[model samples]
Target: MQPGFDDPVFDSQGVFRSVMFATAYPGRIQTLESPSTAPTPLSRAAAALCLTLADIDTPLWLDEATASSEVIAYLHFHCGARILREPGVAVRFAVLSDLGAMPPLSFFHPGDDAYPDRSTTLVVEVQSLTEGPKRRWTGPGIRGTLEIGIAGMPESFWSDWDLNRELYPRGVDVVFTCDRSVLGLPRTIKVES
Candidate 1:
């Protein structure tokens, strides 16, 4: 597999900015220009994110169903990331193919009191990104409230999120990808469903 960035140095930085902006302003949608390409089940934007954020030492977990040998080889060749077969271990990042079919919130590492920043970060693929539904977002980065709607996620997601939120600074951060757009849902953000 080849890198999607025409200029690795600048492109990675660009993607990083996109990621930062999305995470900084939770509930806001950001677009990725020249998103990297990936195998089916993984969006171009997601592939770009994996390339930009993950590296040789990053312990990453891919959805078992979507991680074909070729896909794994691509990531290894490009990012040199270590694949974590055991989800129980402390992994830095987890690539998910379908947000609607995600695992139990507790299945991932939420770090410990000593280092909450060590929690896993989920890179999820969703069906659509919209801000039309009657959902409100309020938290550290948000000013007053932000209304956003992410289509194709199971209602159980919010219920699961509620439990995840209870973990406070010890929960996994989430990044949602759909086509050429990406959105971040840091643990600090609260979803008022």
Candidate 2:
């Protein structure tokens, strides 16, 4: 089995902080330094996120391309996160290796009004965060608007994102990861292509 954080306590705390910062300030790119090594098909940033955010209490759903035995074993051995065989509203987190093939954002758990925080958080592996079609982001964290691009997104992504945003407090949050770089797109953010 692959090892997890060298210093589980400190490293997880650090990664958690970085994740919160990115989520708080949407469209901002956050780099994770010296993250734990993940097996093939699992980017280091995604693995680090799984380690930092998932635990015994969180059920993780891994999409087709990322559901390899190595990744399952790694996450299981390190974080004790239960890997679900199918996707459902109960899934607290999901990891998608191919954004183009991912299920609609609405397919995952979008926590209800009573418990909006119960929504699933998606960790998506992509080619580049700065090389795709640019989109403007405006929301809580962003001052006015922030323009950014992400490679490998499906053409229908922005449209789907619009629907997700319409859900307001009850929608899936996204974390885009490429290599060791991470970018958060919380449900509250509005994006225009």
TM-score winner among the candidates?
2
The digit string of per-residue lDDT tens for model 1 on 1-193 reads 6456677678789889999999998978898865456767778888888878778777788887668787788778777778889776558889988655679778899989999988988898887778335578889788999888887777777787888999987998899998988989998888876
- TM-scores for candidates 1 onward, in order: 0.92, 0.96
Q: What is the alpha-carbon lDDT for the whole of candidate 2?
A: 0.89
Candidate 1 residue 165 C-alpha distance from true site, Å: 1.2
- Which regions of candidate 1 are displaced past 4 Å? 131-133
Q: Rate the local accuracy (lDDT) of all candidates.
A: 0.82, 0.89
Report the error of model 1 at residue 99, Å: 3.3
Error of 2 at 130 (Å): 0.7
Cα displacement (Å) at residue 66, model 2: 0.4
What's the TM for model 1?
A: 0.92
Best by lDDT: 2
